[model samples]
Target: MSINLSSFTPYDLRAKLGEQLNEEVAQAIGYAYAKVTKAKSVCVGGDIRLSSESLKNALAIGLSQAGCRVIDLGLTGTEEMYFATVHYKLDGGIQVTASHNPKNYNGMKFVAKNATPIGRENGLEEIRVLAENILNNYQTSLTNQNLGPIEKHSCLEHYIKHLFTFIDLTKLRPMRLLMNAGNGAAGHVIDAIEQHFQNHDIPIDLIKINNHPDGNFPKGVPNPLLHDCREETSHAVIDHQCDLGIAWDGDFDRCFFFDSKGLFIEGYFIVGLLAEAFLSHDPKQTILHDPRLTWNTIDLVKEAGGKAFPSKTGHAFIKNDMRQRDAVYGGEMSAHHYFRDFFYCDSGMVPWLLVIELLSTKQQNLHNLLKGRIALFPNPGEINFIIEEKEKAIAEVENFFRDQDEKAINIEYFDGLNVEFKNWRFNLRCSNTEALVRLNIETRADPQLLEDKLTLLKCLLNKWIKK
Candidate 1:
């Protein structure tokens, strides 16, 4: 009997361990990626999951069976595969990771040349169909000649060097930093970066918490967005008196930060901070931001003499938009920071480095630097609710506010439903990765108005969810 992979999405194939995802399914997906991308040489990597290695092995075997040379970057994060693909000039790449999902779940992230993402509108659907076709038509027609060779390579040094390019080592302040790896794939990379800094006498003291690469995830999955997941990092920053705190998700693709006072800064504000940082160095640079939270980023960019463009959410959309606009920087409130210098792909490591440089050059504490901005743009961050009828919920929210006693309210559907009033606005959209409907709201220095609207929206969201 042929295997079925119903868990495959446009961006990746994810499933619980030994369930929908197994050796056969992973192999088939690899074969599909090789066939669809016409990749002769490919790079494969995986996180510190127990089942990840087996999946990686299956993927390598499938690539080999398709007569393609596979470069194995053992126990690597998602971005490493991206870096390997473009740096080695390979045809494509795959990284095995569920990315902050439960421990038993594992998945794969795919990309074409130059680390370009293969999403739904791009090549992911094609890859999914081909993978399913291969699975449903499975047979024992395999032979030795069909299998190629799997070579092992390490690009850690190159990746570390690339990260160094984002900041001036000499200008980097000798400050203690609290780093929480969440026992995912970020520890090794963090170690590498720290080593280089130490060797160069950079005097950047890195206080790492949960730094070991443990698939067991004793401290729970490494999603810093979760209020609970950030405690350790935040406490460490406070106890150690660190200048800054950094945390990453399971695959280290998304990075989150806490100020010197151990206050977790929302990623929404980081987008504006980064925009200002880049614009400070070179004015009038184009910055691409997601439409979810626009006013702060737009205002910051414009004030710095930079152009701000809003793109739909998601890495593929952001990267494509960045390329089209030749944007120097792109950021999502979800902690995904993309750089034009880094092949327009998001990087968790780069964001922190850039932020450090901003602090050092400006001679301001992390908290002080962002204090005014946070006060100016108070956001409650993203609130997600599980609603089966996502479309209806969105429409109801839109209709409820559309008839309000207000004029000049703007509405945009760049990614989802964004209803804008002059003093406050909210964006309601179904999550691409989950069944939840996410709502992000911001106000023009009006805390009470923001809270009032948020409470009103929550009530509406609960009403719709119950229905």
Candidate 2:
């Protein structure tokens, strides 16, 4: 009965599998989840992590012990679990996934009925306390009266059908897509989609690499956001002369894109691209963007006749805002895109499908489609610093900018300290789990200004940041 409390984050659990998480801890959390939510039926699924299956099974046992029927989706992405929870009208659902963490790490993500998030503010704290107590002295429900049933179900077919609703297969031009799954859960969905494409006679060719779902992560963990991790997909894009290079994380909740030239497009640009795509036809739709990177998204969204608004970062916040405001789409600079059609949950699969559809509808390659937008708004992307005192560092940065031009700098506290100037802007935010602050800067077609400002910020914060 060993469990590390550090595994619990603001919204979900993510920690080293052996040291911080195991079968017993997962079970306790599962039982607590069932009891606290008073769920009569709970749906469970897992990613390809070596530990996720066992943890999911243990969680199922706990839910069943609490007299909840468990629908086990043998292996699926996080979005699929969200879909199932709402599609079946179940009381709650949980997906066992660490989501872009290292291979040795594993965790679980939770959603209440109708696929609403259950974050720390709402239910996680109660669940954590109850789980810890349960682990202190757990009981085996030998009595059938206390034990519920577990059954396996496949949500893949319906999930893919839902994905296709975003785009018309017949309209897609003949093109090759280099998809790098990075040996994670995404490979399964990619394979399934490929088969569907064949059956539908779609001419699109999927050039898949690192496509096997390996628990050991032979090609490395599935996070393409890292520059080092992006080489495989980028190079493949060039080598295969692909129309688009798409990459997904361990659990496939967020997706990254590369142009045909094998250059990785910053997530900021993709946000704008997607916002414009959605708004071009669906005019006046509300588009939500994170403050960390907003200039481009706001510009594109507004130009497309859509209303653009800012939402705090993270899935919990974005989903909640989307539901509240009835936003059609919400995107973060981190590549997580949420859709209203998908029960306001973020889906890695949906974004790319929409993007490919956009490419087809516009009759342009991915490079041509995004190059103008990238040039119009140049950015250094999000830069993270390993900081000791994150709040102090953020304050120093904010104050220094204000002091430099008190009349010129306008600051807004949305997700972070967003400081705006005449021609350039930046956001400084602290990481919730680590002593790190992320900085994002963008300039209006001023690469030199972007460089000069980035260099200045780097020099200003250098002393306070650790290597």
Candidate 3:
């Protein structure tokens, strides 16, 4: 009945369903979350994963046992939980979703009041301790907890309306776009948006594929960031003559974009594009970005009369940093974009709506909007290596660069080892959830330097991964 507490990573709880995650574990986590946060009102939801409903029901039972009024959101994406928590002014919310993980895996993402994350750094550890105690020894500090009522409510209409607020609907252009849901939780959202566009007389055409919620993941996990997973979206863009292409993962918290030419635009460049879009609308404000790839974002943010700050790379760090700096926007190269107005939470639906509005206002395609920025700041894309001693490998590479480059201008240690020179720079960091070291190299208008630096890093990290 007790599950492995090791499943609680620094960010969220995720692992193989049965061995590391189960109904008992979910209930304990829910009970512990209610106790630790003292959240009297909470919302619970889950994705289309086969196990998610059961896990969510157990979790809600625990919350109800703790006397917390539970709003059950049935089947929804991760962002819906976030929005529900903030929109309804609940004390906490939990979503049973594994995001882009394989079908065999499932997990939970938590948010407190205002949609702030609950993680190891904050209250996840306490939750883990309490949950483990309750699950294994049947112990509790407080006795005779009051049971509260559980209500089934759907916040879909309100959530869909909230998404349109990010862009002006009147300015939306008449263009064809491809939407690939990969048979995840995103299909219903796309369908709803399309129906809204039709009713409102918005002239955009929507082409949908894999637009059904299926636990089977017939198309394989819905992660368009992978090279092979992108084929369907890209080919569909051309086949449908779409002006742009869009795709989402299992939970649809993050979205990927493809240009009209069926070329996959790097999330790095898209970050810059989104920053530009926000600053253009607001004139001036702070923007947060990850150090994995920075030059383009910095250039665009500065040019758009905004200050760009680098934050530690994960969602927890980015959200905290965005609040600290009061940033209007924050983006990571991994396709996560957080908004200031949206309770500082990331949404897959928001970024695309803004982009389409941008295209309509600017009277250009996605490629034209990106080509110049892409050329100005060229990167070979992120290269990842599976290394055993990743920390040691990072230290060695950092020392090598420190010793070699006497003129390294801006060496940042916020999230990773980023050494910046005048023309070229690179960031090498260990992934928190994997045995991999991610390397990112970017050059300022120098393709040759980018290639050379990439080759050098590939050769250097080659030995570390070989073992």
What is the C-alpha lDDT profile of model 1 across 311-344, one tens digit per residue? Answer: 9887888999999999999999999999999999
Ranking by lDDT: 3, 1, 2
How are the candidates ranked when ordered by TM-score, highest leading?
Answer: 3, 1, 2
What is the C-alpha lDDT profile of model 2 across 1-467, one tens digit per residue? 54446678888988886646889888878888988889899899999988888999999998998899999998888999999998788998999998888777899899999999999988998898888766665442222357898999988888888888888788887889999888888888999999999998889899999888888888778888888999988889999989999999998999999999999999888888888877877888999999997888888887889999899888999999999999998999899999999999999999888888888888998789878988888998889888989889888877787777345557877788988888998888989878888999999999999999899999877889665
Find the 10 residues in a row with the least total lDDT in model 1: 137-146
Candidate 3 or 1, higher lDDT = 3
- Please list all clashing residue pairs in model 2, or write none if there are none: none
User: How many clashing pairs per prediction, in order?
Assistant: 0, 0, 0
Please state every model's RMSD to the true fold in angstroms.
Answer: 1.6, 1.9, 1.6
Task: Identify the leading candidate in terms of lDDT.
Answer: 3
Give the per-residue Cα lDDT of candidate 1 at 401.
Answer: 77
Model 1 backbone overlap count = 0
* C-alpha lDDT of residue 61 in model 1: 92
State the weakest 10-residue window (summed lDDT) of model 3: 136-145
lDDT of each: 0.88, 0.87, 0.90
